[model samples]
Target: MKPSIPYLLAYAFTLASRRADEELREHGLTVRQFGLLMQLRLEPELTMAELARQLGISRQSLHEMVGELEQAGHLRREPGATGRTLRLTLVPGTARLLFDAHGPLMRAEEDFLRGMGKREIETLRVLLQRVLAHATDDEAWLA
Candidate 1:
């Protein structure tokens, strides 16, 4: 019997995450940290709760990670529109680190997807986006 799609996806995610972590480690960043920074870079106005949800981490865990990044000067917290919400931002120092890390990460992805043709990759991306859209009930999952 073939493995379930979810099982295959989980296995693939683990393998890909391990490779990404290895690549990111060269820049002194973890996969989670890099993801957090990337999210902030993509959406500068994301609130703590929103960011935590997007990252699929608990608020407490996000807070801890945020603290670590903040201490390392990679992240900054600023006032939000609401008094109870805090906005997350990547500091200037992280720009260089993230820029430097991009190449290694892309290389890792290319390595992982080795032997796949361009059309296969695009099909996989579209399918994943559809799944995400359905799961999240958000049409803008690709955005």
Candidate 2:
């Protein structure tokens, strides 16, 4: 029997995330933590809510991740410009981790799509974005 679309995508994502997670763990980071670092790197000084929104995760979950990261000395916490908001400062440790993991991460992604042709992957990206757009549109209408 053929698996449903969501089931197949979930399976693929789980396997890919596990691979990336293993690579990142060697550097003392989880995939979610790496996502936080990526967010900070891309949009400096994002508040916890903003970070959660950007990552499509809960603020409470992000808060827990931040606590863990700060404890690990990978990040420094600072007060945001606005009232009671929290900001994350990337420590040198995180920068080093991200830099060192670059090759492995890239190779992991390459290995993931090795089974699929480039054109196929590109088409998949377009289709996925269309699906996401419709979902977000429905959400906006509901709001």
Candidate 3:
């Protein structure tokens, strides 16, 4: 029997996450933590709401994650320019760790996508983008 698209997507997500977890393990980061760090690196000083939107996670969960990262010296939160929100900033040392780990993570993804050529990869990207566009939280694609 042929697999449904949702099943295929779930399987792919699991495989990708597993590969990412393994690659990030040496750096002492879980896949979710690595994703959070990357988001912070990409959007410095982002408000908690904006960051939560980008991550497709709850603001409360993000708050907890921020606290953990703060304790680990990976990032910090401070009052936002508007004063109504808190903003996150990635620490320089932690930024370096993220930068260093990026190469290995990309390599891990490439290894997982091994038989795919450039065109195929691009096609897959486009298809995934389409799927993400229809997600309940449409903004998740930004992360």
User: Considering every candidate listed, which one attains the maximal TM-score?
Assistant: 1
- Regions of model 1 farther than 4 Å from truth: none
* lDDT for predicted candidate 2 compared with the true structure: 0.78
Error of 2 at 89 (Å): 1.3
TM-score (C-alpha, index-matched) for candidate 1 = 0.87
- Sort by TM-score, best first: 1, 3, 2
Local accuracy of candidate 3 as per-residue lDDT tens digits, 19-77: 98899888877677888998777668667877787777898898888888888888877
RMSD of each: 1.8, 4.6, 3.0
- Candidate 3 lDDT (Cα, whole model)? 0.81
Q: How would you encode candidate 1's per-residue C-alpha lDDT over 3-87 as one tens digit per residue?
A: 9999999899899999988988888887889889987887898888888887778999999999999988898888888877788
Candidate that would win on lDDT: 1
| Descending-lDDT candidate ranking | 1, 3, 2
Worst 10 residues of 1 by lDDT: 134-143
